[model samples]
Each structure stands twice: as structure tokens, then as C-alpha cells.
Target: MTSPLPFLVVQTALYNRLKNDATLSSLATGVYDFVPETALYPYIHIGEAIDTPDNSHDRYGGQTVATLHVWDQYKGFKRVLQIGSRVQALLDHQPLTITGLTHIVTRYEFGQPLTDPEPPGDIRHLVLRYRIVTEQTP
Candidate 1:
């Protein structure tokens, strides 16, 4: 079976970085394996992660795909966009030290923003996906 340690490591790394960030800290932030119920706008939810085996004949590794959700109840996308930009700056192409894994690289895969009314409410959703490559350490 595949180990979840890499995913957990990536999640922890992102949470550690963003939680301390001046911008994101002001808003409602959640770094978890599942979304939580809360009454907070301009929220940052770091949820959902998947890992796929990316190994070769002489190496063991995996490519992790993770999603970051930026949500706002505000009428415009400006706030979400700004926050998203900050997130990108903090994480995109940045090197991360993940426990139990030797990090290779972390970069943005893509980001899609939209007007979402899911959960039966009006909100702006900016979803960013990232790819983190890693190999087993020791």
C-alpha cells in the first residue's frame, strides 16, 4: 500500500507556511484532510491531496497533487485574487522540506477561478492546484 506520509508532509508544510503569512492569517484558514463547517469569509482551505507513484527502476518517488481553495462571500473577485497571488508567491516553485521524503520540486500546475454558488450560497471560488515531487528519504 502507498504511504500517506508524503501527503501529510506536504499538507503540513503548506499549513506552516501559510498560517504564518500575514495575509492569509487574517482570513479564516483551514488545513485539513476534510472541509469544515464555519462562518468565515475570505477563507483559505487547504484540502484534498492525491499521490501517485512516480518511480523508476532505481528510484522510489511520487508526484503529489494538491488543491487549495480560496473562497470569499464578497461580491467581487479582487480579494480572492490578491490572496491567491500571495499563495502562489509563497508556494509556487518553492522548495519544501517534507519529513520522510526528499523533496525534488514544488510548482503550480494550474488555477481556476469562478463564481460558485455551491452549498446553496453565493461565493467566489479560486481553486489552485499544485504538484510536488518527492522521493523516499532513507
Candidate 2:
């Protein structure tokens, strides 16, 4: 049997978790893989992912490192930081329901804050990352 794509599964699970959370829904406009050009000021965007194999003699496993971006047009980092904290609280060392795979653990890797230096420099960006480890069933 062919093993499932760990990165895609992990990403989907993460998206579902964030999208359905009432707290996140109230904080951000929406969770999106592709953000609309006219999307509102605050939103969560599922960004890049990296998958690496972690196979054993008897089981197939993988590690997926994913990045989530929080964008806001607030005056300072307060808004974005609050949202990022919620994201971390939701996923850090938490359990994820990955389809067709056994979830080992999902750990928060790091968070970075950035500024969009374009014309109006009021845009705030927070980059959050997580590492998800999964293994296939026997």
C-alpha cells in the first residue's frame, strides 16, 4: 500500500483546527491557502511546508515543518501578536488528527514578527511555524 502524504495531511488538519476554532474566527477574517486580493485587514494564511522522511525498519514515518502567516494592518504588533499567541496555544505540543496516519505530536517551532515596508508601513506580519511528526499504521 502506498503511504499517505504527510505534509498534505498535516496541513489539512492544521487548517481544519484553525478554521473551526471560534476564538480564531473572531480574531482573524479567515483561514486561507489562497488569500483574496481584497481580503480584510486581519487573516491567517497557510504558507509553506517541508516534509522529510523518518522511516523505521517496520514503519513509515515523516516530519512536516509548516509555516503559518498572520497578517494584519494594525498600527503596531499587538494585534498580530495576540493572534499568534492563540495559534501557538492551540498547536504547541498538542495532538492533531491526521488522516490515515498516527499523529505523534505537534510542537510549535518558532514565531517571527516582520513589517511590510511598502508605502504605508502600518502592516504587521507574524510568521509562526510548527513541526508535526507522524507515522503510518502497521
Clash count per candidate: 0, 0
Q: What are the lDDT scores of the predictions, listed in order? A: 0.80, 0.90
Best candidate (score: lDDT): 2
lDDT by residue for model 1 (20-71), tens:
7776675545444455686467778887888898987676899999899888
What TM-score does candidate 1 get on C-alpha atoms?
0.85
Question: What is the C-alpha lDDT profile of model 2 across 80-122, one tens digit per residue?
Answer: 9999998998899888888889989888888999999997888
Q: How accurate is candidate 2 locally (lDDT)?
A: 0.90
> How many clashes would you count in candidate 2?
0
The stretch of ten residues in a row with the least summed lDDT in candidate 1 is 26-35
Q: After superposing candidate 2, which stretches have Cα over 4 Å from the reference?
A: none
